[model samples]
Target: MRKHRRIIAAFLLTAVAVGAVNTPAAASPAIDRGALLAQHPLTTYESGAEVGSALTAAGFHTPSSRYGVSLHQLVYRTVDAHGRPTAASGLLVLPRTGDRHLRTVSFGHGTSVYRGDAPSVAPDDMFLSGPAITFASTGFAAVAPDYLGLGAGAGPHPWMDVPTETSASLDLLRAARTFVARQGRTLDREVYAAGFSQGASAALGLARALQGGADPWFRPAAVAPISGAYAMRRVEIPAVFTPEVTPKLGAAYMAYLLSSYDRLHDIYRDPRDVFAAGYTGMGELFDASHPGPEVIAGVPDSVGELLTPRGRELLLHPNARFAAALREADSVCEWQPAVPVRLYVSPGDEQAVTGNATACRSSFAARGARVPAVDVGVDRSFSGMVHEGAELLAVPRIAEWFSALAGSH
Candidate 1:
């Protein structure tokens, strides 16, 4: 395996308050929130065995022996028997101690071609070896789960499924709390779910679901979903192709929805067949099934249809109908906390639905969320740069945000 340099993303809070406004909310103490753990690596091969061990060796194991560090790392299990969606099972990681009931952070990951893993990587198990331990080093317990198939070796990761990922997010958080409590440690039930790319979409969906209805378990103090795919239902996949930002983002999306909806599979027959012998089967079938962007990045037009039959099946399925109805019936962004929410975005992110932050702010405002957002370019040299650091930067701002609201976490 080639060694790729890991970008050690160190993001701390900036701007006590905009306009140099010295409000009480901007005057909170600086908390040592850890590093950022959001990025989709470009890989041609992935094996759970390899990734898992890497995480283990990184000191991501649960119930650890290290001091000033209480860590637990293990693969959580969940069964998706019925037509239900994935559960964020597999490879859970967290820090060992927080005398002051630790605040938990659940990360939503980006695209992986295969469905068996929800935004999963290979055998290296870098969640612990890479970011989870880094997070622990920063004094925060982290819960990172394989959305469904990947770690457990299940087939197909259910990308962008709301209920499944949402529960996974909250359940992981709940599980972490329970794990600590069982070990005679305590954790602040208050948590925040954050993600980037599709994982960001997952985080957004989970946040909405948890808060949109009568949640049995009280939700976190706030939601900080960045670079999310909140508006996937109406994106123009046909308009994407190549190095242009449009196609770069559209490639995996094309493969993902196509992989899920069998009906649409044939519509995107590999155009290469014309030259490859007048075609016998799809060129895609010849490629590996991992959901990496590279595999899908350079495919031909036959693979890039706008209206696919499989999409029709997904659109017409009973659950699909239920989704439409639920969306129409509720029609609101459900924020779990009665407190405030902080939406973050980069203006130059061509991968995102344009004006997403604006639309979100407008829509969420009517729903009663105190959202203080910063609309910046995609080039944030500091920690709050990308779509994943919503809460990362907010931790410092939390003491600031909560201090003003007199909130408790």
Candidate 2:
């Protein structure tokens, strides 16, 4: 982390609504709701070498063959979870060299506790920028949305809110196209999506939304999401109590998820209802300003200790309303993906609880949508094998997978 700098991203809620504005249901027009508020040049990497250096600093390696590229931070208009008009900021990495028939790859970034990890804010952050460079430097137009609450957006981030996550991503795709066109460049109109960790779930949701005709013009070509917690109620939620998993990480995730969920649904009237008195200040952690480790340190040794007895019971055997929210967030792979889709996983991954990939594959298969759950072999320590290792090793492989799909499109 480069001294966490708050870059005062210019956020403006413009007049344009993201989807079709006041259009008839039958007349599904493609609408670009993400209005560009401001654009700032972040940096221009002269070649793959420069991109690699940045990636290394962010704890990763870049793709072997790279192209000179320019990165820009964009503040644009999009709606929030409530469908109210809001603003978001993200990054657009444009390759200086490549085919004139440029296509766009919408990358959903992985988990980051601090708001500073946002692609637009920390352009060199590996989680976002490394993948951005990997895709863009390989001759594709890469766009990484900071999501609704992260980056320059206001309020607490919805860590895994499926609908808003999908909408924000879709809006960014629209924004990217609008921005690219202004530069006298035309895109192939095909959008491919990939993500890791939390982003994997977002990518899956985005794929479902796009396939269901969220955007009439940008059809999905292929989607690959790596090491994601797709099954929350069945696997992810319960795993917090298991000793093998990192209790601190689980506690941090629960704090983020539950606090954000409370805002969307009135599940709890007070923090004490869902969290123990020991976890009084957990709400402050989700302001999107704190770092992951610091947030984790604030949590109890186990998530169970942080939750009230009633809260634990409710979460473990969630009531109708609570369960519904969990189901909605976990329903990433429920819909079929018309395009080629793959769920990359590490069988050895300790971060993600068991059954996430299995459940996703099963859901897709039950719908007669045969999607592969590819296992990316683990070659790192179990600590590394948790999440970051899976991301570091799997991103380039996913990029290669996307490249192979190019000819089919």
Candidate 3:
């Protein structure tokens, strides 16, 4: 265990050194979209065995690995939630292969409250880096965007904001393409989009953007989002008040969502207007710098204790800007996509209910699109809870599905 800890420390040190040495100079007058600001070498797996061992250590299922993997932390330029220019960071994992042209997988990550837990910032975090590493080790270039305000990005994260998630993710793909080009390698135009939980919604949004020609070079080939809260207003919000969601978990999610939405949509004039007197300063805990556990501990167990009655009513029956924001965020599946999509879910998931995936599929069908919701089943043995266990099982399936699609095409 001591040796393992030393190896991780070495990787972190190497990343810091590389980033310090390769940091880009000051930006010019014009902002370059998708510009690679800095690249840091994180770690490398020399063989499939090493990749499997790493996955096992990270508490994720071991997928069939093909090539070794090289992971890097990439700081790139992207627009913030408000459409202002900003810098964001993410993980770029490349497979060690002889092929000059590589297929790409863009993974949207689950919700992260603390900046330190981001994939680029904490590559050893299984939940953050597992999907990206899995895809890369299986021979695809994996790009996992940390989204705005998380990782090395500036400002508080606009959590659950689909537009920023889509923008950040698309920009990372652009940055990855640019980085790979310099190494005599090129990315395939077809991109396989996948994400877990909050990232699952992001993956759907990104696929929509890619289909809508968000980028000139890359296009989404297939989308597979696992355990995502796709229907926020209808399914997700209502579930928060039910027995399905524990009070503590629901309170934390509501706190993060309300605080983030307030930043983008001006949902509340004052913290007191939304939060209960005892929890008036709850929003401040979600400033991205606070540790997630600390933030959770600071808030009350139940949403009722966390919010004012008006605030609770507003969430239950939202109106005005808050309602509009929910509509926008919930509209991820409103548009029809030209590419195939599969929504993965676990029926036992307490946080993001399985209803979300079903609701998303219904929305897609309403738009004359056929999308399937696949159940990854529940893992009783895994201690990360049903939500995370769902992701653990779903990633390998997503990789296999993506590989098959690539093979067919």
Candidate 4:
């Protein structure tokens, strides 16, 4: 197991080394969104057994891998939060099979404060890359977007902004389709969408876009999102002030959210307007350079301690543009999905409470979409956090569901 892990790590490091020296290509005037700008070979698993071993060593449940997988880091054109064209990066994993036509799955990744933690850049970080690799080794071409500003993309990540998340995901699909075509593989129109944490919301957003005909070619076949803060205004924001969530976790999330919103919506004229005296520099912590641990360390213990009195009031009873932004971000589940959808959650999740998923199901039901929020159960292991554990338990089941759906189609 150690040897298999070493092989994976070495190859990933080598890919980064190779990618570092390559100069980015000049932007084309007529280049469309999702246009492939650059591609770097990352790593390859020789067989299904090797793929399974690598994943097992990384702490994921042993999955059935039918084929070897090859991974590539793709720098593609995508729009940033401001609607201007920018270069964003993602991972494109392909199954080593004789088939020329491939079913596709797009996996939106969980939250990461640092850019280096992105899947395309850190394939060995199972939390980010595992699902994409799992889908690829199981015969689906997996596209994992690093999202705007989180990979090699050029801006501060827009945190929970769902529009950019959907756009980054949609454009990555377009880029992946083009990349696969160059290798003589044609992607099917049906895209199986899945994600975890912040990404779960992204997956739902992507599904809504695809179902609503945001893209001319691709349509969502099925969606399975795990432990997302889908109903931010109704469930997530309220939970942060309660004892249900840990103070550190809640503060960190609040800091990230406000800073990101401030960038996109001008939520505050300055950080001091929102943050408390000591924590006023909170916005600088989420600039896509600092590590998550650093951000957590920089903040006060609780959301109440971190925010000013006015700031706390704004979050509790948001008004004006802040209210509108939260409303927009929280609306991912408001539409009725035409495809089969499942919301995976753990009742013990300390960060994003399971109530978020419950709220999402209620919203979906109101829209006549009877989506099920499946409990993947809590991770009881000594070393596991419930939030991370839920994802570990959920990915394999989601992969199995996607495979069955792909086969049926």
Candidate 4 lDDT at 32 equals 74
Q: Provide the TM-score for each candidate, comma-separated.
A: 0.60, 0.89, 0.93, 0.92
Provide C-alpha RMSD values for all models, in order: 14.5, 4.4, 4.1, 4.2
**Best prediction by lDDT:** 4
User: How much lDDT does each candidate structure score?
Assistant: 0.42, 0.75, 0.83, 0.83
Would you list the rank order by lDDT, best first?
Answer: 4, 3, 2, 1
Q: Which stretches of candidate 4 lie over 4 Å from their true place?
A: 1-31, 380-383
Off by over 4 Å in 1: 1-72, 79-93, 96-100, 114-135, 212-218, 234-244, 261-294, 301-337, 368-370, 380-409
Deviation from truth (RMSD, Å), model 3: 4.1
By TM-score, rank the candidates, best first: 3, 4, 2, 1
Which regions of candidate 3 are displaced past 4 Å? 1-30, 380-384
> TM-score of the candidate numbered 1?
0.60
Q: Enumerate residue pairs that collide in model 2.
A: 18-33
Error at 371, model 2, angstroms: 1.6
Q: Put down candidate 1 lDDT per residue, 326-373, tens digits, no spaces.
A: 343223243434645666565555555545555556667766765656
Query: Candidate 3's residue-wise lDDT over 1-409, tens digit each?
Result: 0001111323233233223323234433455679887788887889878888878776677678888899898888777665556778889999999889999999988888877768887787766787898999888999999888777776688899999999999989989999999899999999999999899989989999989988888998999999888889899888988888777889889988898888888888888888988787766788877776677778888887888888888898886999999998889889998988998988878889888888899999999999988988887445557887887889988999999899999
